[model samples]
Target: MRRLLEGVVPGELLLHYLSLLARGRLSVEEAPGLLDGAGNIDALIREGMAYCHGDDHSMLVAASPDLVLQRALARMAGHLAAEHQRLLDGQERLRAIQAPTDATAGGAMDQLVQILTDGGKIAELTLTLAGSAQRDWLILGARMAADASDATSTSANCRALYESRCVASAGERESVEAVIRAGGMVRLAPRVGMSMRLADEAIALLPLSERNPSGALLIQSSVIVGALREYFELLWERATPYGVPDVEEGPLPPIQMKILRLLVQGLSDTVVAERVGVSVTTVGRHVTAIREALGVQHRFALGVVAVQQGLVE
Candidate 1:
């Protein structure tokens, strides 16, 4: 089912139909032709892009694609939440099973911690943990020259916090941008003292030393994992979203602010214009103004700076 819809409908077509629907430009009469032109009405319906009505199912309607997409995303988030709870439950079960043995062996603390000194083994385990993440994957203090493949291999819901000074190079920026393109969320912190990875809210991988990547401590203790999770969240709230501005800018107009927020969310200029009741050219103008105001040379940088400046929450 997922594979069938992977590339069946172009995003532009969906957004166009939805924009028309929102503006009352798409009547029942117009929906048929547009849906037909889309060439995948069934897939559209499944994705909440189109609706069928009437006794003979002759009536057709276009739905707000954004609303439908948001609902779908909410469902995915609910599933991730449930999976996280299940992992916690399984940890409880394991603790119950190991109670007697742990008492005899001093404690389960020793069992929960594993040290790896080999570089190859550490790298392999990093990928393994990242690839197997089903819920949240939190990365803190990512290196400047970190491999993009590590970030790309994780689930779509990954969040990374990197030191601001580390990603100064264009190559590092590209690597971080690749992560964003792959659906990973990134934030920049002025300083990130420790490098850590938390997977599925169940396990954590911490480098044994800041200067070395060849040694790590893999921990499955809930106490430690929960503490790390809280720490990550604290840093996440304080850190700026990955794009920092080179210059301070004045506040934007309300309409431009609205458009900027939408743009930062990966919406197209066409969609932003439609949503804001402006022309596409107007959106482009506003984008250009925003880029100049933020001292950025590109759209991606514009988004990052908007986020960093609190223009887009």
Candidate 2:
């Protein structure tokens, strides 16, 4: 089983500990002795294969092998899904790069589109454009919050339009709020099909496809940049300003309210527990109670509903 789980369990020491726990060869007390300089018993506990108890003398208890395997497989599935999305994005970028370039007024395609295949180069160019913008910066997408933040910090006026569905998660909401708080304007559209940035009407950065961070087309041609700016303006006119709901709800207990604020800020359960001076289990219980109070099912929806109900700011 250990050999089969080679890459799945992450580390050999952790795998050995899991196997020992599953085989009942390692007792709770004896487990601590196995923790040498290279061994990390906490890894097993974090992966849901083991747990600790007792306040003064913490003891580790192993979970069932079935539960451990299930959790490991679930984590692997998540990684595979992310990788599949990346592959699709890469394919889309490849197709765009291979397509015929458009001719300008001079009947030449020179310097119209520059393919940026390196992620670091893409980020550096984005930052440079944002920092150098003196008039205005326009953006359309979910992942350009950092660029918007930079633009707002400069002398340039920044305006961003994002799809409502794409910006629903807590982390996304927090980022959008950060941009707004930095004096940038944000609007929500029903759908934003592409990721793009236009700086001062001189240059445009368009990702090859949605969610493709590593590849983009940097366009300096005035014709294409002008068209993209017009497209952004048309969408901006129809989009709604980013604003919180006007509805109000009953107040929650002080502790729950604190937890709710942290949750809305996109803090994880473990971090929230530490900040609130409570156990993770207790924090989870409060999370469930908060969800019920707000009438939301998932954690993402919980943050959205909490903000909508004016329960947390």
Candidate 3:
């Protein structure tokens, strides 16, 4: 031990320690104290232990080449399994979110049409109309609403298809009348300021800046839709179902329609006559014809009727 690290340790003593180390009779950590810190034989033994023998560096510094390879393969297996699970979970979530939203709905009109067309899984629909409601849209709403319960198919499509009800804002009377004529329950809400159209499953929240009423956010979340349904029911409960009043009628001549358009544009009879290429008296006659046709008695009522019926822009 004294001569081992002193640079003169005997080969026999070195072999004895080496044999002991190989037989597990000595540990590398324990062997450091058996030397005097010098000697080629001791240094050789330490070098062989540090570099060649798997127990020193391989077992202590890190795993051996073969064991390291096995561990790497195991980790790869675990990582692949985890990734497969994550992918499956993601796919399931995607399917859940996509299923309900896409198969059932689209834009406001599309949703309305789909619901009205299906008619099953739905009971009653309450529709709100804007003053400038498009004739085509109004017709679609009314006709579809009526057909939902036609009693012709006998498919039991609707469990209780109540009368198609509508809440129309002022200046929407004509469209309201169209719906009413199709057997809808119509209520004229005079002071009700127009917002986007509201229905049972979907509601349109249109930007006020957009002129197109269909330009809207179609909300479909069940909580929001259910709340809207409840509120509309409240309004429907209090609303009075109105019918058109009876009065003497006159046919609306094409010239009378032109005169009415001109009148609404802040134009006088003379201006209307010039625009229509007719005399002022002729324009006045057209205006009178419009008044009689509309069931109104005077010029102001004619304008009112024009607005109510969506005759102007």
Worst 10 residues of 2 by lDDT: 101-110
Query: Alpha carbon lDDT of residue 44, candidate 2?
Result: 74
Lowest-scoring 10 consecutive residues by lDDT in candidate 1?
A: 1-10
- How high is the CA lDDT of each candidate model? 0.68, 0.70, 0.43
lDDT tens readout by residue for model 1, 1-313: 2233234445655554555456543445556476565455556566666677666666566665456556567767888999999999998888788665633223443468777676665666677677878877778886412334677676425778888876799877887766554446678999877899888888888888888766788888899999999999999999987543333533654565677889888999899878988667546655765665567898888767877877766
What does candidate 3's lDDT look like per residue over 1-313, in tens digits?
2232223333544454444445443344544444333353355444332222454532212113344334445666888999999999998897577656543233233233232333321112322322212221111122232222221122111111123334344534444543333323334333323332343243433222224322234454667655655645555555444553433322343455567888998888788888988656446544654564477887877777888877666
Q: What TM-score would every model get versus the actual structure?
A: 0.45, 0.43, 0.26
Pairs with steric clashes in candidate 3: 5-38
> Candidate 2 — what's its lDDT?
0.70
lDDT of 2 by residue, 1-313 (tens): 5655557677865555665576554455667567542246667767787666556434666767667778999999999999999999998786466455432111222467787666665666677777778778777885642343553444466778889985778887877766554446678999977889888988898877666565778898899999999999999899987743333525555667788899889899999889988667557656765665567788789777877877767
Better of 1 and 2 by TM-score: 1
